[model samples]
Target: MYIVNEGPNNAPTRGTLKRRDIDDNTGGTPIIGIPNLHIDEGELMQGGQWITYILHSDGISQLRLVRIDGQEQQTLYCAPANTHIANMQLSYNGQNVVFNQYPNDGGKPSLYLLSLASGSLQLLLHPQNDLAYTPTTWLDNTHILLTSFIPNSGAPRNDLYALDIIQGSNQHDTDLQKLFSQNWSCGSFDVSYDTTKLYVANCDASNGLSATGPTTISVQPSMGGTPQPIAHLNQAVTMLRAVSPTMLLLMVENGSGDTSQNGLWRMNTDGTGLTRLTDDTTGGQSLCPYSQYAWSNVTQDSKLFALQETDPHSADRKLYYGSLDMGTLTPFADIADGTDMRLVGWTLY
Candidate 1:
């Protein structure tokens, strides 16, 4: 398994671990180190051969694509002199990659796209200072869905937009469409495996970004329709993914010392069979302390590769794997307490 060691301390490191070395009761360490790279957040390309990630080193941030085995690397794009790369998403088909740029070290972030086949980078949308842009998921190889709202508007809602990856193409060979709009600001969204429905988290924006408010889970048509509520959550949702056509994987934020409010959860699309897969306890003692911030850092295979930060702000952390069918948990790595670990999963060694 591949894991990222990010810090409140040192340069980020990447390494690989053996799944066999892990068990439910004991933790393990990386078996090999990935040279001198200082980047972390990544997702596998559709073919599972390459990974796209953001690089933050020296005084620059870049969007990069690297081969899985560490034998080759490529810098697909780099932020301008005083700017840096921010949010990013890779199409499910593995052809295109899109991300945002924070200019002047501040201001609205603009969206950009890169073509893996052509090595071409294009500005898809300009940065709007008042409105915030967050890439949600790819509807298809050439289309992506995202939500945006006025930063700190304190309003109760956000708008969803669809972008065409191919310069001259439309959603249906016509024009991109607004899939859905609601009264609640949606933090993130996912499409069912079959790509028929949109699963979203409707959140509160009172504190600034809509992600911080009380969150709710709902599903609606990918085209346009009224939403069908799934569950009203007490904690803010940090990540939401559809595991199967009828099931979902949910991670909620509980950074504070409230054990009951955190952990990995799974439920049916209709909101049935909900289960907490880890201990969301707050403390310096609990073996598993889940944080919503790293929710997107995952890799799925026979089971799941995930983690739990010991505290909201500390480096104490652990890597674990669990059964998607039973919601059973097991510990794989016990990162040294105070050793900030920013991360992901996959097997390269």
Candidate 2:
């Protein structure tokens, strides 16, 4: 099953969620999850004047893009051949799209790029041995920061590498520069707007592949520099986004107790001034960290969008848009029935 939501303010009015069996011989019956929510404004466009995302069928993966209103676009922008497309990010201008493609059968993965204007598809990296996943962010229009995992080693872990897309083609191998090697899995990372520093989440305390201690979020300069720990959380920090050089958005699970009830937190880049945004104490369901949330630029301030699962009665998910104000939160749209809507990626046009 796959779904796509426009954003907090631009949701669809009436659509159907169909679930089809992929292996069925006769093409089985389609199960509808929920109705689609409508948006008053049209779809997003190429320029940095609107916002939009691409929802794929895997239910947990998606690609982000910007498109014009009533464009009647198809799902071929970043389609991975014989693989599942996950973890996508768009360039600042929304012209280039980068994502990770994992083969369905099993093998080392590669990074892919899509030219929205030219409709050209290219593979950026095809590792000889290790498997790559979870591309952090675009350092520039031609370079991307990513993590690769080499299996069977004593300590299987993710290492940071910079992939230069302009150096090679899909038929040939590209150049990959090893930036830093770590003992733990690299969760999420973001590059500064000026491309000077990088903020990353990792379990850097232990020696094994799976570090047992609380995850540490840190920032390092693009040039050689020590990684300074920004915040130490009791639980594992799964996802993070840098709203600016001074602010960060994070999703944290409880370290001591229940892991299902993850909470949303915002804090300064240096780890001071921590603020809790969402509380899941009562009955609020946890949002999908990868596919449910995004931050956008609106003038000087930033806006947040997510598929909020308010309560059990709220049809599983609704598109929500809110301001980045400290104490106040306002909803721009309430999608009554966007159940199958999985956020792939977002672009500010």
Name the best candidate (by TM-score): 1
| Model 1: per-residue Cα lDDT over 305-341, one tens digit each | 4554566455556655666666576655566655544
Residue 291, model 2, lDDT:
27
On the 0 to 100 scale, the lDDT of residue 237 in model 2 is: 61
TM-score of 1: 0.75
- Per-model TM-score, in order, reads 0.75, 0.65
Largest lDDT belongs to which candidate? Answer: 1
lDDT of 2 at 179: 72
- How much lDDT does each candidate structure score? 0.59, 0.51
**Residue pairs clashing, model 1:** 6-342
The positional error of residue 262 in candidate 1, measured at the CA in angstroms, is 2.7
Least accurate 10 contiguous residues by lDDT in model 2 = 25-34
Clashes of 1: 1
